[model samples]
Target: MINSRKTDHLEICAQKDVESGNPGFDCIELDARSNPGADFKAVDTSTKFLGKKFRFPLMFEAVSGGTRKAGEFNKSLASIAQEYGLGFGVGSQRAMIEDKSVADTFKVRDVAPDIFLVANIGAVQLNYGYGVEQCREAVESIEADALALHFNPLQEVFQPEGDTNFYDLTKKVNEVCRKLKVPVIAKGVGNGLNLADVEKLDVDAIDVGGVGGTSWAIIESGRSGNGCRLFDDFGVPTVECLLELGELGKPLIASGGVRSGVDAAKSIALGASLAGVALPLVKNYFSGGAKAVEKWLSQFMFEFKTSMFLTGSFKVEDLRGKVLL
Candidate 1:
């Protein structure tokens, strides 16, 4: 199921634009040439995440642990992330947990030993027997700096083998938060983050996986034989989610439909601590290889720096409050 589903996701992505509603990058207007005196070469593109500094405030986002191809992709991507000083997130380790033989597939520590690595897992899967112990094992297995708990109800409802009984999830989240040594990040997969939903969670951060980026509902429709077609477009756009959840004050990760460095810069300008992107890279990488992925990512950094320079925002951290119109 994991292998097939992973492939299905990629196929669907290649066929069409699977992004949810407008992620809201368009709504944000970057402040123009206000500081004509600010030197472009002096622009600083560095920022910190999970207590570590990264050259760019960009995340490869989670999409891992399924097939041999997925594993190979992860290994190469992890190396590039480490070489460039960016954060890397492994896909769900559920497959490894269910079968130890597949563990090596998600093992990226060897390639990106020092990068800020994040372990991935479905939060709702906790209600079915997952616990703090499993979460610990996941982090330990990946040598991860933090653990990201993904909330993907929309996608699951469309999956034939979906488990929608999310009962006791909040209880489990708080329990795990108390016991885990690392920070717990709350992420909504293509559904956007809700402060109310996480009010009870002792999360260290939140990824506004709002809509306007990969509409999982649509992706599942292709796999589930159109059963989920009715709700193809759902959830709050990424931009709206960010603006709404930014008030909560938790470290925000803008994912969903973040396409370019300009889009990433837009997210940071509107309170995102870091921006996350996955779909575009997955497509490009599949068509090319590691170099393709690197070239594309390097472009993000270039555009991000260009955006910073144009806005006269010299620092990545200060962009949140100073650059957005």
Candidate 2:
């Protein structure tokens, strides 16, 4: 059953038309003409997130947990994070938390000792009274710098064995944030958070896992054969979500449908501290191995640098509020 489940994720992630048609990048354009002689060499991609400095404004978004393959995948991801000097997030740790025997599946810190890592769990898991101890254990088990509570009720609702009890989820999340020693990030799973929601949350950062990339609804529908077309197009586009949350005065990480450095640059211009890519990285990791993944990430960072140069912005902070063409 576990093997088949992993295969299902692998297949759908690798071969499905999961990206939304109207990715938010269309709504934003950088004023590249403003800097005809911009120096690309001076562009700085450094960012301070959750009290730690990252050499690049990119994070390896969460991807796996539940099997031996997951362990191998995370190890490779950790190595890449260390090599590129970026942040990394693991997939939902619920499976491993429930059974210590599979703990190694979520253990990537053993590989990248100095890289910033974020431990993940579903917001719904907090309602079960998992408490600070469990949250700490997840982070300690990983030696993570932060904890990410993923909000994927839509995906959960679509999955056959998904959890339905979402009562007091925000309160539970707030409690978790208050209790945990490390920073807590409220992450959306391809259904980006709006400004209103962001204002009400107590998380230190927000991962706008917007629509346009890896539609969990479509992925879940594909896995279940439920044929719910309505869900296929749900969630805000990455650019739009970034714009909405840009004024919220908190660090934001952009995800979902962010394919290139331009996309990453657009995200930064729209107010994202970092841009994260998951499905593309996962596919590369599975097919071409670590070297393939490293090559892809290096290209992404290069693209971001190019965008920064074109905008005449030498630092990530300089990219903020810059006029969009």
Candidate 3:
């Protein structure tokens, strides 16, 4: 059942019109300078997260897994991360947890041994009998560098078999963060994370999978007979989330409608540690292949570097709180 859902999600996301909302990137523009006072050819986009250095502040966010075809996508995506020195995350591992035989579908250490790989699972699962043990297994089984406990109450509400029991989920997440050996990330599955909700999570980082990217509600609605269409545009925009969560003192990962390197640069300037791309990369992979994925990323980085240069920011760190409207 879980495996089937994974396939359904990948198919709908790749083939259907799943994206909605404005990530607010369109409103935020970089202060461009004709002569940046630095060499454009020497712009540096490298940064460190989870003690690993990324060639650029770009992460191939959690997109697929839990099936043979999904496994191929994971391998291809991870290889791209390895080649580019970026971060990679697999989709929810609930399928592997339910049936261990499918665990290989989420493992990519053989091909992406050096990149910062993140293992993912639904935080709501904690309310459904998943705890530290299961969380650890998800990480160790895949040799992941960190763990992203994704909160998807909105998507679950739309899912036909959704586990909407979010009662005291924060307490369980804190327990896992304390007990889990690897760094724990509190992630939102679209619909972004608010300040109040973020204060409750003792996570090491945050992936504001805000709206403006793939609408999980829309995806579930497609599977559940279009009942969730009303909430297709739900959640905070990615830019708003960054503005609200910038002072929390935790590394921020900006996702949801991050289409290009310029969007990525805006995110970094607003205090995001990394800019994540999911649906577009998924589409690129399906429509083309690994080479296509690589091509898209290459262009994204080019645009990001161009933004950095035009903004007079040499390194990724220089962009923090520097760019203006």
Candidate 1 error regions (>4 Å): 323-325
**What is candidate 3's lDDT per residue for 24-121, written digit by digit as tens?**
99997887888799788789878999798998788899977889999999999999899888999999988898899999999999999999999999
Query: Would you list the clashing residue pairs of candidate 3?
Result: none
lDDT score of residue 314 within candidate 3: 93
Return whichever of 1 and 2 wins on lDDT.
1
- Which candidate achieves the best TM-score against the true structure? 3
Q: Using lDDT as the measure, what is the rank order of every candidate, best first?
A: 3, 1, 2
lDDT of 3: 0.90
Instruction: Give Cα-based local distance difference scores for all models.
Output: 0.84, 0.82, 0.90
Worst 10 residues of 2 by lDDT: 1-10
Superposed Cα deviation of residue 267, candidate 3 (Å) = 0.1
Model 2 agreement with the true structure over 1-325: per-residue lDDT tens digits: 4445655886788776676545578777887756436567777788888788789988899988778888888888888888778899988777777788988888877678888899998888777767777888888888899999888878889988777688867777888889888999989878777677667889899998988888878888888899878877687777777777777788899998889998888888877888888989878877888888878888888888887887778888888766564
The TM-score of predicted model 3 comes to 0.98
Kindly report the root-mean-square deviation of model 3 from the true structure over all alpha carbons: 0.9
Using lDDT as the measure, which candidate wins? 3
TM per model? 0.96, 0.94, 0.98
